[model samples]
Target: MFSLLSSTFGISRPLILKPQTWRIFSSTHVNHALPMDPERRKKLDERNERRRFRIAHDPEYQAKQDEDKKQRRLRYASDPQYREKLLEFGHIWNTRKSQDPEYVEACNASIRARQRSFDKLRVRLQAENPRYRLRKSLHQWCLKHDWVRETLPWKTHQPVLFASKVHKECKGCTRVKVREGVKLWWRKIGDRDESWLCHACHMPMDNHTAAMPYGYEDVTTMEGIINRKQELERTAKG
Candidate 1:
């Protein structure tokens, strides 16, 4: 009888015999009803974390994903029969799964984990990548300058149009044509603002006039980026 009971629930024979153990293992307990294997669950969580991280951070992956979603949305909007079928399937699946408290708990846990992972990754990237920080600054500057719209169907200008508007009379020298306008310098604080400045003052051809002691260089390229990152790190130490 002991062996039979032990084999039935995979618990030790002694535990099965104990009244206290039985109470602890009662069906009323949510955890006792369904328990995930620790090792398997960890592997699944790691896999999901990696997938979510890539989707949230990778630009190439995001572009492909955006295109796929755009196509799916177009199809869903155009094909009534297909859309209906999808709606029916989604409704049924949601209705069935909504009744499962375990499934709901698992989904909530996964969402929370994904969000935590995303936040950490974003913070790390912001700390490590100068390019990302530069872009974010530009985005904020654009918003501040009213160069872009607030809501969807944004009035953001194309590169050429944006350049035209951004390149007008230098904020420093007030010379629009006689002097070449320079955009934000990745390395200099004065040049990083939204307003344009004359190249002579903000971005010198020889880098002698640059506020920062370092010479002006394009850090946008991969090799240049690594070199620039090291330079910044070295500068920070001093």
Candidate 2:
């Protein structure tokens, strides 16, 4: 790897062969010579429990931990190498955990319980909050459209409709599609403007078109609007 980097970046071999570089590299290859004695393991567990208690009860320590976590997340996002390494480690860890059926079952049960609680809370919020009700209704209306539904990808983690592919942001509201489904409309043929329109922005235009608000001699329906959008998308792609 060093030789490849040297060849690619034109770094001198002597620089990589320095004593300081060797010392740093060797330091990372520490051997676990100490055996896990029962007493030592018990002491370590007690120390970890104390640390956890301190983190939970101490405001200063908690704040420091939160800051440290934020910094780690920022670094993970900005540093591709670090992100890749972390992902690789996580994949390996998950793979090992998944090999145990009992562990997998426990994880699945916990996830299901959390999802049920979240769903109940969401339903209650929708019933109580007028704003939430309107937002959720608008979002549901958008999902009834074929084009918008197709854009969402399936996920193994969450079992919900339109639960995946949240990267697209709506042009009108700047909200992601995953929060509420979005409609990507192509205004005309041969023009490819990836303008994402969330339900809140799309509904008014849809209503206006259906109402023939401009007094034009044209009739429009929800199906007609969806069909037109799909046709325009195909034309733009072609």
Candidate 3:
């Protein structure tokens, strides 16, 4: 009858009694089969408990997990491509407002106000101190030189101011060399006048002797230096 039923249903007879099914049938037929080893089961349960405890109590693992989440959040927030895409979307959304005249005017006005305030402060500071004024003048001279170079391509001859004294072993030998000379003439460049050195440093082989005025004392303190510099500036101006 089973063979007839299998042939009618087109089913393989061997598949109906597969190995797993046969094992179940045999176990059912034989009662009181040996149960799983209690020791092995207990060992498996202990291993699972240890795994759970390790996951719950490991401080380093918890810290690493937290660090990963923090880095992920930072990457998402600071990704340039993501920000650019967002900006592109915003541009599309505010196509008309992007070109609005009122917004541009407001931005320009804020910038101009900031520039004016900065200029006023700069002027006041330069007027308050001689050193500040000298520095401002030097900066203006450099800017004017740059502007002149830009406007006149062939004007390669530039008037450079140099210091009068040269140092032999000083760290600023190059600077001293560049600054050697006296200010024969003064001219305003941008915001201040340029000054030239009154004397030039003698070359190492040259017979030039260091000249110090009789009874001259060296200034050491910052205040003394400032006073001396002011006196020098006054003399130069005269």
Candidate 4:
């Protein structure tokens, strides 16, 4: 009868016979099954809450937000019309993306292409105007003058000849002449009979007093007069 009972509960016989077996089993499983202490859990929750509060209230985060706001304000202030249009387009795009992304992209592309065409036309018009070229040349000249003042001088003044109708005058007789184009001349400066004749007028005057300075032969051109005036203005400024 004992053998039959032992066979029926073979593996669990020692556990039922020994009272200390329950204590050993309980000790091994207690650590795995027990819940965390309430106070420690509460302290951890408080710490996490404090961390989140600190992050939300940090001055650096606030400063970053303020800087972003300021940049947005400046951008909008500088280009209110563009900003308004962009914002309106953004809203439309967001609202319609699911329904009409392709249409929105096509509309934006067409507007950009039209704007580029208008810009190109404006550039071409400015380029065709000679006055615009002159102004640009004058501006570049001024910029170069600003770089090296000791060696290079700025020419800010317009020539009196440009304003006056007459560009040529006889130094000897004080006779002014208004000609359609540039005129050269030889003039006797004083009673000593010191005379200098420009190449253009010297061709007609056989008795022209003296041959001009070496490069003066080439100085009879319109470009020469402009260059001479520019040089004089630069010298005066320096």
The number of the candidate with the highest TM-score is 2
Models 1 onward score TM values of 0.28, 0.30, 0.28, 0.25
Order the candidates by TM-score, highest first.
2, 3, 1, 4
- Kindly indicate the candidate among 1 and 2 with the higher TM-score: 2
lDDT of 4 by residue, 68-182 (tens): 7677667756987856664454344334432455644544565587789999999999889654544444333323433222222222211111222334453333332323323
Candidate lDDT (C-alpha), each: 0.44, 0.44, 0.38, 0.40
Please identify which of the two predictions, 1 or 4, would achieve the higher lDDT against the true structure: 1
Q: Give me candidate 3's TM-score against the actual structure.
A: 0.28
Q: Candidate 1 regions off by >4 Å?
A: 1-41, 101-238
Candidate 2 per-residue C-alpha lDDT over 1-238 given as tens digits, one digit per residue, 9 for 90 to 100 = 4333222222221112323233212212211111124465455446556767988899998898778777877896799997666555444444554466764555466558778999999888768964444445435534565544344221111111343444445445655443454233212223365444444454343332321212221323455545656665687799
Q: Distance from true position, residue 53, model 3, in Å?
A: 46
Which rank order by lDDT, best down to worst? Answer: 2, 1, 4, 3
Write one digit per residue (lDDT tens) for candidate 3, span 1-238.
2223222222121212322232211111211111124464455446546645765799886676668757755764789775455445434423433365664454456558778999999888768864444434433443445432232211212333324333223221345444452332222224343322222221112322111111112432335534665676688699
Model 1 lDDT tens row, 1-238:
2223222332211211323223322211122112245664455446556756887899898787678777877886799986766545444444554467875676567558778999999899877865554455434433344322221112112111234423455444656452443343222233344443343334333432222223323333334534665677788798
Superposition error at 58 for model 4 (Å) = 69
